[model samples]
Target: MKGKNALEMCARAEYGEMRGKNAFEMCAEAGYGEMKGKNALEMCAGAGYGEMKGKNAFEMCAGAGYGGMRGKNAFEMCARAE
Candidate 1:
């Protein structure tokens, strides 16, 4: 609510589908994403290491941030904003 564009800052925050994971993956994983909840994998289908084919898997909780009801990320930071 200022001249600095506060909305932009929130958008930058790593939440929701900021990565290749379900919108509820990050938060839901803490307790539920799946009944297993053993590791981050339970949040999605990471194959085993949260990635595949050099690129992040579609279900990983770490990749690019975008798309609602679908998927955080380190490498995605360098990616051009879609």
Candidate 2:
């Protein structure tokens, strides 16, 4: 049981990392990669928008599915292909 929980946590961390990396790549493609201060790529790559004190780019892209849903991560939204 302890191993299962550990694996689950590891999987969640990996998932978040993948999501952040993908978000950064997508932002780069869309020309939102760079900025004068903190770049969008960094923002997406590291903590994402949620950790920046609000919702992440992926969650915002989710539209209606994430409407009014507070305290939920981007993983809850089915906007991106998994």
Candidate 3:
């Protein structure tokens, strides 16, 4: 999906006041784990999925190794330094 659509869906997941199965499924379907940049981290973190959080962290590391800070820097730094 496009960055905008992913971001909008994430925003909807965050503040649309939707909850339970629908919200969880929507967040899962938004492909938040596959998103890039800060938006990806925010959405993944906010989604409250343990697997998604781990995936996001891994993506962040890969992005860092690729030499692009984007959203990975913070995650990688925190994970490693901890």
Quantify all predictions' global Cα lDDT against the true fold.
Answer: 0.36, 0.37, 0.40
Which residue runs of candidate 3 sit more than 4 Å off their true CA positions? Answer: 1-4, 8-48, 57-82
Candidate 1 vs 3: which has more TM-score? 1
TM-score of 2: 0.28
lDDT of 3: 0.40
Off by over 4 Å in 1: 1-29, 33-36, 46-74, 77-82
Writing each residue's lDDT as its tens digit, candidate 1 over 1-82 gives: 1221222433354555533443334333444324334433333443334343134334342443446312334223223233
How do the residues 4-80 of candidate 2 rate in per-residue lDDT, one tens digit apiece?
32223323334433333343343343433342234333444443344343434444434323345343344443222
Cα-based TM-score, every candidate: 0.23, 0.28, 0.20
Cα-based lDDT at residue 7, candidate 1: 29
Ranking by lDDT: 3, 2, 1
Worst 10 residues of 2 by lDDT: 1-10
Task: Rank by TM-score, highest first.
Answer: 2, 1, 3
Model 2 misplaced stretches (Cα beyond 4 Å): 1-24, 33-41, 45-66, 78-82
The global Cα lDDT (0 to 1) of model 1 is 0.36
lDDT per residue for candidate 3 within 7-31, as digits (tens), equals 3433444434332223234445454
2 or 3, greater by TM-score: 2
